[model samples]
Target: MSATLHRLDARHGRAPSLDPMVQLVAGDMNMVNAAILDRMQSQIPLIPELAGHLIAGGGKRMRPMLTLASARLLGYTGNRHYRLAAAVEFIHTATLLHDDVVDGSDLRRGKRTANLIWGNPASVLVGDFLFSRSFELMVEDGSLKVLKILSNASAVIAEGEVNQLTAARRVETSEERYLDIIGAKTAALFAAACRIAAVVAERPEAEEAALDAYGRNLGIAFQLVDDAIDYVSDAGTMGKDAGDDFREGKATLPVILAYARGGPEERVFWKAAMEGHRASDDDFAHAVGLIRSTRAIDDTLARARHYAQRAIDALGGFAAGQAKEAMIEAVEFAVARAY
Candidate 1:
């Protein structure tokens, strides 16, 4: 293992000193829970092709890991973490399936999207199956509170997706609305992951609240980086193209901020090329130029840093444990990653 991973494992017993994110990677629970996850796959003759394709092309199971690691760091030893982890992963996968369909994306994780290969109908249905299966797994965990958290998060995710669809091409997207969508879609799961850990650990209300905030801030920081990456990154490395947001006429933070800073001519150009779908190759270059001219990339990075710091701050109330350190490392890792 890498030194970072090893350090996390070595400090696992010393709770409140090591970072939980690192422990999740370095310790044995990661392997054990992952093996438990693998067993969920079984023969279903009719659904074999679609199921195989989706599972085989998996992305990082960051959401599930968040759930499992949060519980472990909180001193949870029950196997419920396994089911919760699997449920979170299943929810993430279902969202990906629907997202590919909504974005009409052909590629993800450097491979063909399930929708692209199986067609939208099959992809949507399989996504539904996963959603149902996730709930089934949660139910098997037998905690009504856990069921409620995931259920609420799932609804919020759907709401965020709808908000994105309706808000597309609208030039007047406020920062408030933007945050609303992101919190619901991205942060909700993060909050759920941590909250469930508190529940499993039988932590006090204050501790649960702190863990929830940690997840919330971490999630916001994560999506901010993701949105910024859309503007600045190469599709090959990003597993999706640059300006995917522009092509979809969706106003991300950079686009939103750039609009706030644009001259009349720049505004008109964005309206026609981006919101209006009348864009040509030249328009793409122009939009990039405009975003760069305004330093929106830097602006977005500053905002990302703010959220990352908030995420770190949330851990302070904890007893300076290894889990808290891991939480901090995960935030730093998110920020240092290329956006």
Candidate 2:
């Protein structure tokens, strides 16, 4: 394990639960949940059915909580945050729907993926419907600024997906390039979600930007831990097959690092397994051995810790309180997932 992770383990024992952050915004979250169920409703039974299945599967609901907690941090007390929170969730859910089709996976959040149950066509189309509904919510807010931030994020997220597609199965993918991919694909929405809270609160540009920075760094850390854990986590723990990234030829950070540090024979192993999509159980075992031997997972967790610290530092300007502390704790909660 990385020294940083070791220190954290000695200090905290384990990752703090997200419950404190959830409790901090429970009232607002209730409103956001109501709006989510209400907005997801449609006359077409299939649309609601499919969307509801995924929604009912349950996620951490952390993104919208960031939106709510951020607004509270800025002392905003308006109902607009609720609608905006729901819209943020809709955007996230829509992306997950599309991503499952793209990744061709069977599980999400410990349940069968929407795409697996409803088929890709229904999943993709319903995802589009959610995208449309998100836009409608933004339009209802009547804030061009909100629309611009979210719409821009929506576009950048799609671009990030395409970027990942381009980089997939390419063993030569660089760390910098991988960071760029996750920044847009994952962090862009996080940045937008938090930024809008400040926007609704009419806070200063500095505060908005600070919150955006917090979310951006936190999102990056979150994805990095995700990549690292996928190498070791079980199907039950990770909610997807272990080595799914390898099976799909995804050039995530861990694989990229392992490839870079591996000997000539190991490089050839990665190339053949990735290119041919022929990673058998033995090949997977070998890959894990290489990753552990090279300290790739340790290094990946180290980088995630770096971003998590940056996320906490970004909240320095906020007053010390529940909102700020919860946000700070969120940084720990995000990075500690690797353990």
Candidate 3:
């Protein structure tokens, strides 16, 4: 974590800690990471090489960790969660690869994207391979319910990607539509990841629903902060170039709000920069200025906080413990990235 993040976390009491949760699930997480490494291996050589580059890129593995932590919290003693976590990660990594292609992104997790190092075709094909591998793991688990949840999430994610593609460079995108897009694109997997823990643990239906709700809300808040960070964070801080969203003309929450509040002249600037592809560094700066002036970032963060609180509240039925606390901190961590 950055120093700035530490300060922000400190202000919120001891409610913002991932360490306790990570430590509690450390053994299971290690097994999940090993499974990820083992599953990435193939005779093609290039497959593991390219996939490992992203897998080892030092992400916190937050999604899979959620799966592991959820199972541990629910008192699961079986090994199924490890495999499930690995499968969850595979699904997520596959999406990242394809997303980088669609966005023409060069950086991910602070490293050059595989699509940049290799060609787009290779990156995309490898992503397909990972998706297939994830399904195989799901089959090994021998649960139609788990398969249905993950498969449905994968389909929803694809629909979200298509929605985002169509919405890009169109400033007329509504906040409701934007939320729908992010909810499907990003939150679906999170919801699946957590919900599957209950499936494997054979928990009650109410517990399963609560975990799904927690993951869904956290995922939405995470994306909201991510969009806000794109307008303000630097490559060193966020692992991707600042203003990449603006450059790509992604009509994220901040952009939607700013465009809505802008005057006619400001609207012209927004249209020219976002729709007409006339954005330069200076124009990007000016766009940031306008967004800040409009308090779009503040509004975006406020919306994110609302979801974060919802995520925290979803754990109301679960007893207070290390895992539950970690899950709550994870929600705060998601929102804190924008700081």
Candidate 4:
């Protein structure tokens, strides 16, 4: 983990932190991870193989951890938090599987995506299987409110996918439109993950809402940071290629912000890179230069920082403890993470 920070500093030039949140989260994250790992092993022949494909890819498991840690921070004392944590994670992984298929993506965290490795048909079916599994687990929780939250989030995620597909490769996509898409696709689940923690804790509605706001803003920050890394970070550090958004013709925050501030030459470059599918190597390089010259990266970082701050602020309403402190550090750490 220290190596990660060194790379971030040597490259994008981030500050050295006293405690990196990923590492802190890592210390105890695997306790909850075991629940998912164990559930993922249930066999039905090929179904096991399909599940292994995603599990072996070894994601950060951020969603589940958020649920677990939020519950702990809020002083919950029960085993239900673990199950709900797994439920949210299943939903998240299922979405990723479907997303890779829909976007025709071949890579994620530098590994072959499920659609790329298992064929799209298998990926799609496996994703459906996982979604069903998540729904079943949510039902086991036996709380209609929790069921409703997950169901609503799932629907929003589906809508977000369709919205992005409809807007794909279009230079006309505005900043507001992009935000709405990401808010639905990414932030909705995040908000539910934390809000459900409060529900399981049997906490008041006010506490639930505060955690929901934290998750929502933090999720937005996570997406913006992801978009920033898509342009700025290296494959080794980011676990994905730079210009991923570019290759997909996705009008990310930097691109949208840059376009809004570009001159005639920059505008022409933006149009060609986004709309004209056939882009030269020179076009990608020029787009990077244009983005760098405009301070779009700085602006995007500012927005991410704002959301991170909002997350920490929301935490203030909760009780003071290690979990709370870790949550604050985690929010800040994610904003400054190498990946």
lDDT of 1 at 263: 90
lDDT of candidates 1 onward, in order:
0.75, 0.87, 0.88, 0.79
lDDT for each residue of candidate 4 in 264-333, tens digit (9 for 90 to 100): 8888778778885536667777877888899888888888888878777777666666676667766766
Better of 1 and 4 by lDDT: 4
The runs of at least 3 residues in candidate 3 whose Cα sits more than 4 Å from the true structure, single-residue gaps closed, are 1-15, 233-235
**TM-scores across all candidates?**
0.88, 0.95, 0.94, 0.90
User: On residues 1-339, what C-alpha lDDT tens digit does candidate 3 reach at each position?
Assistant: 111121223345644556766787888888999999999999999999999999999888888988988897798999988888999999999999999999889988778999999989989999999999999999999999999999999999999999999998998899999999999999999999999999999988998999999899999999999899888946456676788889888889998999999999988888877784757888888998999999999999999998988887788788766677677777878887776
Give a tens-digit lDDT track for model 1, residues 1-339: 112221211323333322446455455346534643464455664354675566666555667667666776677776677777777777877888898899898878778888888899987887887888888888888889889989999999999999988888886788789888899889999888878888878888887887788789889888987888777746457576777778888878888888889999878877765576655656777777888899987888788878877777777665555565667778776765643
- Sort every candidate by TM-score, greatest first: 2, 3, 4, 1
Segments in model 2 whose C-alpha atoms lie over 4 Å from true places: 1-14
Clashes of each: 11, 0, 0, 0
Candidate 1, which segments miss by more than 4 Å at Cα? Answer: 1-23, 26-43, 46-48, 233-235, 276-279
Candidate 4, overall lDDT? 0.79
TM-score for candidate 1, please give it: 0.88
The stretch of ten residues in a row with the least summed lDDT in candidate 3 is 1-10
Model 4 clash pairs are none
1 or 3, which is superior by lDDT? 3
Model 4 stretches with alpha carbons more than 4 Å out: 1-31, 41-43, 233-235, 276-278
